[model samples]
Target: MTDRLKLMQGNEAVAEAALAAGARFFAGYPITPSTEIAEIMAARLPAAGGRFIQMEDEIAGISAVIGASLAGQKAFTATSGPGFSLMQENLGFAAMVEAPCVVVNVQRLGPGTGIPTAPGQGDVMQARWGTHGDHPAVAFCPGSVREAYDLTIQAFNAAERLRTPVILLLDEIVAHMREGVHLPPPDELVIIDRPRPAGPPGSIGAAPAYRPGKGEVPAIPDFGTGYRFHVTGLVHDETGLPVNDSRVADGLIRRLHRKIELARREITFTRACRLEDAQVAVIAYGSAARSARQAVREARERGVQAGFLQLQTIWPFPAEEVANLSRRVPQLIVAEMNLGQLEAEVRRAVSGKAEVIPLTSGGGRLFTPEEILGAICTAPGGRLKKVVHQ
Candidate 1:
């Protein structure tokens, strides 16, 4: 791929990447830290022969995206804390009905508008569990401006290939950061559109439109594409009718999860340095991982065998990888801007095979490399200096 450098903000790069990924429709309400994404799409989508709509609210925004996806258009939306909160139900609806779309949440400090412009990794858990029930989610977290663009394209690809709602969770630091990025030529980038049926439409020989595809994903015929199918939140069979029978519901739920769960390696991506030969390892994602990487390097320079694991994919947490890393490293440092969310998951995965130490700050400030290295300096006996900033 030939290099074409562009001075772009992370949010703008994401919007450009979305267009390159063939996102023809965008429906979203303006929200702080993420409104630039909507603004860019509004201006450029029509020029690309696509559609963009500023909806009434976050809920309606996602609702329209879901409808567009069912109509066989690649769709997306962007939001922040409160707007992300408002999107939960429709997010679930998209998951339940097997709609493919992307949702970007540029996070801010929150539990109810604690801070708007400040950075926080508070929405990590919400990206996975904000929606109700036992639905599966594939969420990506990018740590740099370049990664923000690259991962946004991957997010759209995952949504198209898996037939599920994919979330790109970005902290304010990564969302608003401006830097030079070498973007590849649009034609050189591999664009995977949603797969279409092979056979001719409605002749003597044709497969049922509702037939389950790979990963138990139902093959949806685009609206007005001659084939019609039903969609509902209720647990249904291949035909998509509401069903209450216990066995039927159980099978339906399994299919929904299989799309994301069954292809773990394909969907999960991470960056690790010196992990195989390290005694101490730090695990982090989003902006927190940026500091974690620097801290690990500084610790290694101080004659400590330190490693860093940066998560590019946050959801469907890499259980097998985390479990194996647990037995290898004597101490695992789980760092975050929020209060110990991924730490709990790592602890459970490690299962006491190694010491699980958490480095956290919830008052919206990101962890510095010194702060993380401090945790590394003081071990089982020493407390993490200022675990909560507030």
Candidate 2:
């Protein structure tokens, strides 16, 4: 049986879902829009037999979470744009070490803390290219509080399964919004744990800790569990020690990307609403999608055949599906809080298959449904569409 519907804020849902996903440690510094996650985690984690820590800064926060994950604990951290920027270097370090952990970025107006309490999705590109190298990036953006809860658990599972850091991107709109949701029973939820080396730490042959056992991801044993292995930021081999050879470096980097690229089908997720036999389609995500959905309904009311595409997975973007939509529709409208961040990706995916129209906002407010519906009606065939509507 499902639990009774309970009202919860988006950030609170993320914290609760993390707990349900077997997160035993949380390290974070409080920031606006995202502080509630840390606050709720602080109060709830200890009671749930978990640990919570408030680090001096965002860098230390992510570092601690990485360390905790290495020591055999499911760990995560939450922050906003400014804090997320501070964690980029260590985020790269986590990728290099192949540590499985989750990082939540509750986006706020940015570039340097533009607005602490306002919502903005300018981090869409940064979430994928924040770090300084060619490492794999996995990120998800939720459109509602319920999606916040579901995607948080999925983020943790993806981290463990992919052996990399997974980002859960939220905005001030959803982060603070309250919604009623019926949570699934704990036993019914699927929780994925990282693969651990067999035979405890030292019972069998002294194999390399990073050696791939079954799949591309290695089953590294927990630190201090009688396993002797090195972990470093430099390019390393299966033994986890630093390597200097070019071939070894190339191989390591390629494997890091290949593991994630090969699993694209499993990681990418999206929702197409009323796309069949539509004249126009709107691609939106996060809070912006809430408006796009209503716009679609309103457009239908006005005799405009409009569809909505909700992007749940932002990075490693659902390009193929977007291309498919472009083939079917004559025009595609992309609405987002940021100025054409993801719209650029959609254009690349469309590649002249259809007309690309962007309705973007750098301002810290959401676009209204009427605003989107206007774009849907006036996109490219404004005069002709009006005649058809009449």
Candidate 3:
């Protein structure tokens, strides 16, 4: 018999996943819809020989996690909309310094505490471009409670493997709702360790200890490993030293981008339901994916050829897969919590090959199955009619 399990809130699952992923340090401040993550982390991390600290604010929370990560411990932090916004500058710093860490944002209503307890997907675009500069970051979204566990592990692995900050984007509904989740055996899951320095301890010239080779992600040495290096936010060369030379700046920027971009194939993940013979496809991510799946199922029940493309990896935008599906489907509806954030990217990928419809909601509210069904039915040239839920 298959080993299947019981109910778990998304936040609790996140805590469990972090422990399983070897996260040794967590620092976060409590905020609605995301407080459970911090609470569970605080309670469970100690039992797993880990540490948890509740900082004064989100800024201090992220700063502490960065410090812990630099010390060679897997570190993480959790927050919601307003708190996530506070961590932006530090998140940018982590990206610039190529620190390995994870940040979980259980998205709530946005734009200055719009709704504390309600759910919202308004942070979709913020996850991508909230931080300043050209640094690369990866954000993953999980639709189910089980995925909350799986993807949290994936988020930490991606952070350590790529030597960058990874964001796990969860919505209020999924974060608060309880569902069955199977805890995978340790051996069954693949965990990624950060790249380590290959050269001798004292063999360093001018290059930084953490700087990697061309087209490669460098291993970051632990803080007290007798290897001395500098970490800075300014654009720097291999030595992590601020440089004014145009060629050095150019090389550093290109290499920073190339390392992550080249790893795109490893970073992208998606789920397709009933798309093999569908005339219409629905693209959704995060919590919205759950309702989209229901809408697709209902349409299919009525003999409509409808399917769903659920994104697990939101950043790096699975363009190829989406574009391919667009070619096969006549109509594509992009559903999100925001008013056309990922939808814009979907449009670009489809390139007018299919009719792209955007279904959005704000202020921490998620799209209902009825709303999604209506959007699908009213799509131009689609066979769907407005779905009325009583």
Candidate 4:
């Protein structure tokens, strides 16, 4: 453990984890809080017999990643808020074509570059619905550098397994923070490559490239691998060719959503601290969870039964977990770096079962433990009654 331990920043952990997960191609533009990831990939990928390219912009970056992934290279890209917005079109394209790729978004304060060096969780809703049209999304948000490494690999695994784009959402605070991480040995890592075609169900002939197998995932072969197939962003049939029929379009889109919706339980990752028997609970993710964790500990020290729930997966939102926690506790506090983006979702999940309180910051700063502890100690009745804007 000691030998594998290293002091690494969150961005560095993500880059290393992608490599460990078999990523061989990275194409991204440098953006604050996320540039380190691209830099590390650029510096280290070539030596690992991998390839790295700095694209002119975020749009091109994600497009290149999709192309590389289709070409059979485990590929990814990195960006912050503004860049993430630019890549939305291509991100949707990747989802439509069932391309396996990972997009690391180190979120900074934004609505047109609000603040590059500041942290914000405002993109929670955007990450889930930024792209046009209806499409399934898989995204992970890590609360620490260690989780950053672990979840980065999980992101790639999910992308490959689902044959869809995955988002690794980070905030500026976590991206820049350094922590001592004990990386797992390479042998212990569970790496999963996308399923390849083995011909159709019977007959022993080539399988339809976009045909759905178990879990609605298609075993599309890699480009240039001698298997003839087509990949397109437009609605298509099982053969991967574009089709204009409403029935074909409807079925294809629904199946794409079904692949992820059915796997919701498997994709959602969460950590709860002392939530088993608590009078009050705090739900948070990313950097905000760090402070929330500290606050939970201090609340217990002061004889308050405060629990903490940290969301490691942001998209395909953990509505069930939040709903369950709401039924258990009379009050739930949601701490985040945005203006209640996820707080709204928690309210919808709780469905009036509990009083949902929001402790939010407007980016650039983080909540101190005392801030969250105050909210926990002052819950409704005698506790919190309104949003606590930090």
| Candidate 1 local lDDT, residue 148 | 90
The lDDT of each candidate is 0.86, 0.90, 0.86, 0.90
Q: 309-388, model 2: which lDDT tens digit per residue?
A: 99999988899999999999889999999889998899999999999999989858988999999899887632235364
lDDT (0-100) at residue 58 of candidate 3? 98
Residue 132, model 2: lDDT of: 88
List clash counts for every candidate, in order: 0, 0, 5, 6
Model 1 lDDT tens row, 163-246:
899999998989898888888778788777775566557753335554667766666767777764578888876666777899
List the candidates ranked by TM-score, beginning with the highest: 2, 4, 3, 1
For candidate 1, the C-alpha RMSD (Å) to the true structure equals: 4.8
| Candidate 1: segments with Cα more than 4 A from true spot | 1-4, 203-206, 380-390
Give the TM-score of each candidate. 0.94, 0.96, 0.94, 0.95
Candidate 2 wrong stretches, greater than 4 Å: 1-4, 202-206, 381-390
> For candidate 3, lDDT tens digit of each residue in 1-390?
977677799999898888888998999899988898888888888888889999999999999999999889999999999999999999999988888999999988777878788888888788899998876769999998988999999999889988889999998898999987678888898898787676656774324665675446777677777777778888776667787888977776677778889889888989998998887888998888989999999988876778899999998788899999988998998888877888889989999998888887764577788888888777764584567899
Q: lDDT (0-100) at residue 62 of candidate 1?
A: 96
lDDT of candidate 2 vs native?
Answer: 0.90
- Is 3 or 4 the stronger prediction by TM-score? 4
